[model samples]
Target: MAFLPTSYEEMKQAGLDSVDFVYICGDAYVDHPSFGCAIITRTLEAFGYTCAILAQPDWNKDEEFLQFGEPRLGFLISAGNIDSMVNHYSVNRRRRDKDNYSDQGIMGKRPDRATIVYSQVVRRLFPHANILIGGIEASLRRLAHYDYWDDAVRRSILIDSQADLLMFGMGENTIIEVADALNSGMKIQDLVYIRGTAWKTKSLDSIFDDYIVLPSYEEVKTDKYAYAKSFMIQHENQDAIQSKMLIEPYDGWYVVVNQPPLPLSQEEMDFTYSLPYERTFHPKYTYIPAIEEVQFSITSNRGCFGNCAFCAITSHQGRIISTRSVESVVEEAKTITKMKNFKGYIHDIGGPSANFSRPACDKQREYGACAKRECLWPRKCPNMKVDHSHYVEMLDAVRELPGIKKVFIRSGIRYDYLMYDQDDTMFDRLVQYHVSGQLKVAPEHVSAEVLDKMGKPRKELYFKFVDKFYQKNKQFNKNQFLVPYLMSSHPGSTLKDAIELACYLKKIHHTPKQVQDFYPTPGTLATCMYYTEMDPRTKKPVYVAKTYHEKLEQRVLMQYSYPKNYALVKKALIKAGREDLIGNGPKCLIKTYPPRMVSKKKSSKKHIDK
Candidate 1:
């Protein structure tokens, strides 16, 4: 049933004639054609070795491995689209029989099911291959990690995954150097000298000396509940220092951290946009029935300017938006139309902060000048600039392309930046050409303190933009709706904040059913704050959301439209001192919450008395 050559022997006979020096196999989501994979594979291509991307392959099945016959199998490279280290830790922690493992203040929680399954498969299929694992997940867990979910300290994923080397950070430069060395007949052991990778060394006889020493499973396994609490208190600043402790050796397997964030140059951006992207969905995989079926993707830019405390983009791509040219983007659009399966609409064309076409500050010369901890809050950056001409042109070209009916801006666009448009022309253009009934924007949180902590715009700005957006829609007779993305239980959020946000939503009469809970990801500032009460590097006391009730309230307030949620919303409002909004108020939930609550409270009292 697998789409592979008949057998391993058959694959062997097919030979290395068509083989490339390296074969990359891993999660396709991270090795996205526009982002991670494009950068890595192109970089390897630059070094004169043919590198084939076996993206999201079923490494667990022997048949999947046979599709690409052995090409000397230089090194197995994996980094993008895998589970976050925190997610992995959470899985391990949850498996433990302990109540001490809590969600804490993490955001973007996803299961590590793929990585665990894939790693096992790769270990079995490619026993002789030099397996190198890196990416956000592997990098963050390169050293001994105290998994809050697992409630115990765990060893590095590299050792457990059976990878030969582990490269960390943005792997473009490091992966290139690695491929070049291997092509030159250098041994895998020789790759330890690289600055941005983690690998085992022959000299590492006893234990990894560079990483922070954590309690072994044996020491903490029996009393893990107590051990987790102690570990949380002791390593409160673990997130910030976690990356710093990974050391680089002069010669052997070492961990690389603190490498200056790599901003894709204009040329690199052009190359990415130049790739032959068949914007049409692959029909064979279309039966899976997901958004990818109706939607197509194109990257207008790479990286983001908003370095929110909870985000890994700043750490990974740095706070710079490298954009592609209008011509190149149009060319890709044209190619999409030529495809037989083309549905005539390109769903999304943007990347980390789509509105950030060109960064306000020149990072190369003015790196330290833009070192402010937050960008979206306070709006103090005089350097903040907007270039909508390219976007305008790109949208125009996309519309003009044959068979393409609509081009949706599916990715998150910075509302604050978009608001800065001198005129409503961009919004007008978006309404006229881009939107498909709904436009998505992430307001994150409405509470000022919470927004500040999350490095997002003030609540007022979100409302202001919503008003303006709707005003434009009404003026243009457009039926498009605005969908705001909200994050709950961030580091500084509380029940009061959640209640205030809920009240605001009620005031606007806006109800969004899809809201995400904050899942702390690795290498993010927010995660560090969650893990340790202090800034991992600064060791300064910071506000953190630790209670479950507050988290629940935050979630309930975000979607208080349903009758079932009215009591919860009213309770949250009352708890937050916003009882005035409870009944017959502009945002009153009396119609939904009042009747149910009175009867429920009486029933509860009756039960208590009995």
Candidate 2:
């Protein structure tokens, strides 16, 4: 029930000679379910496995890794909640100045590619130890991936990390099975049969399931087309029910990934969140910046069905939605009310996609998500269930809880999904109760081609949603604002496309405060397109904004109202042959000249002397 032992003294104090797993992490230890390490470690403890927390340890030497001596079952490694490469660097591939996961928002707390670095160090120290790597870093990079940092295709993290086993996706059940098997005296090398795991083997002779072999490491590394094909195959097989075992070939070894594990049942989800989490950072640290946001928040669900191209939720959490029971969420809210600093507000009560509280359709429960189609992209599938009644009921219950003043859905709302639902009761309640003055939604791009490439709904759909939102606000007699999250420089976004998006914004008289530049991280359809300049599904050519200058221009166009971006906006407009926009017209993005320059041109010698 106490914090997991982070040192040998704590281990002795807990009367354990050795732990079943040494959970080495890149982030500072925070015992919250929001942190994957906490959930995994807590689940292990619930099942009677001892775990030692080795968080943000010195990777420059192996001595720090020796502190735990050796875990009895294995060394469980994770780069915390965020991928280490992403944690260390930004979308522009620059080293970040701050790390929220670190103590006191410090930087350089964890090494670059922390999972690989920590695993390699542990392997050197404990050559024969069982090394298991999971979390976002290992999960997304479990296969041949185009790493943006290296700008090259890299083999599975299972191979590079020298780990004995790699677990992907939500590992609650997978870890327990692996722990029980390891506890039952199964070797790490023999863990290939477990679902949601990928392992490196010298030979594929032991494989028994019907599996597909992906292109070799050499092939994907050298051939972009082959890489795109391989990525699409991987993307399609993400569902648990329909996915097959995937084998990726290397020179002397093959990495075989078993089909995804079945989605957690509602009871399992409730139990997972009900675990006795300290719900804060360890006592040793005064503050962990990551904890503040989630400390009072409740996660009511897991997984996402939206499955946007730029997001890795599908690859990491899978497409099927797994939700905690309403009673479970309400209980968590009650606990939050009892906290010493209990504010009346509950920060969030949603997961990856807030509106998704069940499977996309009943078919998903039986056959898994349609590999070739999406639930709410291009168009909502006819068979998909479009109801938010249960979600509204759940929220109603939470907001009614004693000591709870307001519950906000800050995670995100899929406006298209909301608009598709015939019943607007959820929308009504959201406007009346949950709007903390502003509701934020993602309308990533306005251009049809760019929207298609991002797997987002059409701009027309967003416009309809916008009108509906404002209409509802008017009906409620509330003056609420809709903050649309727009992204720039995504794959397939040419200069013209960006300009079109800017024009759409101009029509609304709204300038986005921030524009998310397309980040080509690993294991995403968009990232594949960014690397190959081709859509994996159709194999059609796609435009990618690769250069920093061009990407900046696109970003500037999104915020064209700012005077600092005038030069770049003008350049982009002229290059795209929108020179007519240079004049001082109502629809123009930028003027032909700055006020200072124009004033100087009109100034006379006499006016200057005066």
Candidate 3:
């Protein structure tokens, strides 16, 4: 199979004077469906268009971006599979040492905020090209929102990037419409009515449809209450069928986002995956750490309805689940078996949530997700349809394939939804064949108050799931474990809450090796809470562990069993008035002596020796 051109020589060898689009990216050119740049380029090729890739162009020099030259149509830009800021820095805002998307996991290949930087560079060169930016960075920052890196509200990325249009969400269908419009001699300015897109305009006179004008950028920037109110409105209007156009005003121009694209149908999903994909990184690099996990994996579905507070899936992919047909997934599995390094195993056959292979309910699929409530949070909606029979059947089919020995589900599974399913067939199958000794599930926190803020189910639900998992393991005579994903320092989690979590961890005899601190990324409800110190949905005051020391203590509490964390954990326990946990009791988190006292005793002995 021939790969798309990424340099001038390759473009010429392919015998193309000028291509339909010049796709610029902040990631190495990996021609796999998992990467957004690859999908868009391949999809355009299938639809009678020529495209060349400019992956990870050097932002400081014009030569890197000029390699592919100006395109016949426009330039399509993405900040790779991950947001550039998140990839470059940690929650502590410390520069990260490795970039998985870069060649050899090296850092500094791409700039921080690569999308804006690349777009600005291209704009300077091309000046009049149709610049369209999308992917996680553009999608989440489509409107005026909070930027964690800047530590303040930022304008819409479209305005900053000076792009003609911004495609939000999974833009397979959206890109096709855009290409068709541009091909028919339509200017980017005239393509405003397209769904699943946001653009910057100077006037609201052309907006003839029903729309809601959000609080002006200035208002949300200054007033936390206005910011919360603005976020609540956007969250409610995320549905495709029932959503109206949303407009956000700036000083002179405005950012208008059209209703999201409808979720892909089964046939459409099949077609998208069926396109030609090299399914590996380009030959230029000997290694790319990002490919190791996904090289053998298959994305069976897209989109998520499990609207966790910290996740940005609802903002980017929306809350509707769209899955591929069983045949399509099986075909992809067959392809995997024939690859150069074929193994008898399929690493994963999953998506956002493995078991969520269908919509939450018939009403959600036909009408739209309910604006007032989440499908599985605060309690599963009465109308929610909880079943796993089809998922079980698909897994059975995949595992039974010719060269497949095992098909594992590695994506996060919604334990609450799994428990809600009446049929134990999928649950039985999961325990029987799917799990790899341990299944990972996210039970972000144990305290009810913190879980409510995180939109996770009650701790009681997690305990129930744990008991049922072990019961199934015993029934099948297998020794399996449940590795619960824990989070620390999320909004509404205080010192007392952290101590309670530590006590729960002590009771369970499981201390997580790695605990994630809450990162205030854009377009997430939890981020809003972290910044505003209030639940945007209810407008109620919420506590946030904003101080560095408090965040450190919370993280230490989760991993309190480690020898190095003794001092911090002891300090946290004492500060929370839970000094009872410091002594050597059966349920105590740490030993009696603080590390400081031990150090002081050692120092005294050294002084006497001197």
Candidate 4:
């Protein structure tokens, strides 16, 4: 199948004078099903709507937004698959030199806060064009959120972008309804009834008969407690079955986010994947680095139930798990084998969480995920269902397929879920065939208090999983290693907690090459905690490493085994009143001597006076 027209000349070459919708994306145009723009535009095209793309327009050049002229239905904007700020800057807020979404791994193709910038570009050039924003950037920032790059709370992106509508979350169903509504002559404001959409309006009196109102934007910005209170409401109401259309007042106007749509059914997932995707970036551009890893991989499912406080999966994809049938996955595997680049290996066959091939439990479909309780946090509920047999069966089928030498699951596996299952068949086979010498799993931190605040199960579960993993490897006569992903300075992580984790890593003889400092992005429970210094769930005080220096200290402490971090690690130990950890004992985290520090106590008269 031919790819969607990306230029005015191509649009005319396709015998269309005017396109219905012009989609603007910050990413290099890849026609793969995994990309959001591909799915939304293809779904629209399936319904017989004309569409074109304007990928990564130069924000400084307002004329760039005028490509494809003006669409009949208006403009669709996305900040690519990732938030632009996250893409442009590293966790330390340093400007990154390479962007995988750009051609040849170059940076600066998309402007900062790309959705808002692109929206502003469209609004400036074509004042009447309906601007609809979606994708991860708009999904998470649909409401007032903490901006880590700016270090302040900001209003909903709809307010800043002046976009007519925002489709939050996975937009397959939502975009279709939106297109139908707009196609049926419904005005932008009149499309309010569509679930999984948000809009800015001066009055909400006309919208809902029964709705939940969050604290005003001013209150959330000024009062951390108010922010926490409002976020708690947003989190509980995100489910499609039980969710309510929510409204938050923003000065004279309101930013109303409609209820999220239901997770795509198995049949629907299969159809979307079955679409005629060119399955690669447009041929005009060559050598895109982003598609390299996923070009041969398969996505078997969507949504994540793990709901780690730091993850965006819950906010964007929601907690429900839905999967394509095994036949569908196997069909895709056969297709992969036919590709010229086929190396007899499938890079990955997984989703947001690799092992989450089904809903958390049988009750999820009928009753919805429990609003008050998480399925697998604090403790796995007695009624919760745990099985990985189907997943194992799928892997076995793929492995047995002709011309398929090996299939690896690089997408992260939920170790906690693995430990909960009684049967070890899936675990055994995963070690035997899928692992590529190492398996990557996130433990985040080893401190119980830190993991508790992270919405992770107890540290004991991770330790148990590690032991079992090694045992399984031994049984299989394999030598796969576990690469634990650890994080630092999440809310409730104290210097003492960092020290505790350092000690634990030392005991395990596993010092991570790099430790990720907690990045307080929009729409995460941990971000709420990061901004407010309190858990939204309990509104209890949490010790967040707020200052940049404190964040650095915590990061360095996680890699305390490194020589470069010796000074910082020693300083942190002394500051935490655990100078005992700096001595030359087996338990000591750092060596006995300080590094070239002339004692300030002996250098200054003020120190003597004190």
Write down the worst ten-residue block by lDDT for model 3. 601-610
lDDT for model 1:
0.58
- Tens digit of lDDT per residue, candidate 3, span 21-46? 99989899998888999888999999
Question: Each model's RMSD to truth, in Å?
Answer: 8.7, 5.0, 4.9, 6.1
lDDT of each: 0.58, 0.90, 0.89, 0.87
Tens digits of per-residue lDDT, candidate 2, 1-610, equal: 6999998888899998888899999999999999999999999999999999999999986777898898899999999898888888888889899999999999998989999999999999999999999999999999999999998899899999999999999999999999999999988877778999999888877777799999999999999999998998999999999999999999899999999888999999999999999999999997899977798899988889999999999999999999988899889988889989878899998999998999999989888999998888778899989888779989999999889999989999988888988998999999999988888889888888999999998888888888888888889998888877888999999999999988888777777666789888888899999999999989999989999998998999988877778888888888999998788899887777853433233332110000
TM-score of every prediction relative to native: 0.75, 0.97, 0.97, 0.95
Give one digit per residue, the lDDT tens place, for model 1 in 153-224. 555566667677777656666777777777678878666566566665444554434554334434433443
Sort by lDDT, best first: what order?
2, 3, 4, 1
Off by over 4 Å in 1: 1-73, 77-128, 139-148, 151-156, 159-162, 169-173, 192-196, 199-254, 258-261, 273-295, 363-369, 372-374, 423-425, 534-549, 570-579, 591-610
Per-residue error for 238 in candidate 4, Å, reads 0.6
Deviation from native of the Cα of residue 116 in model 4, angstroms: 0.7
After superposition, candidate 4 runs with Cα above 4 Å error? 593-610
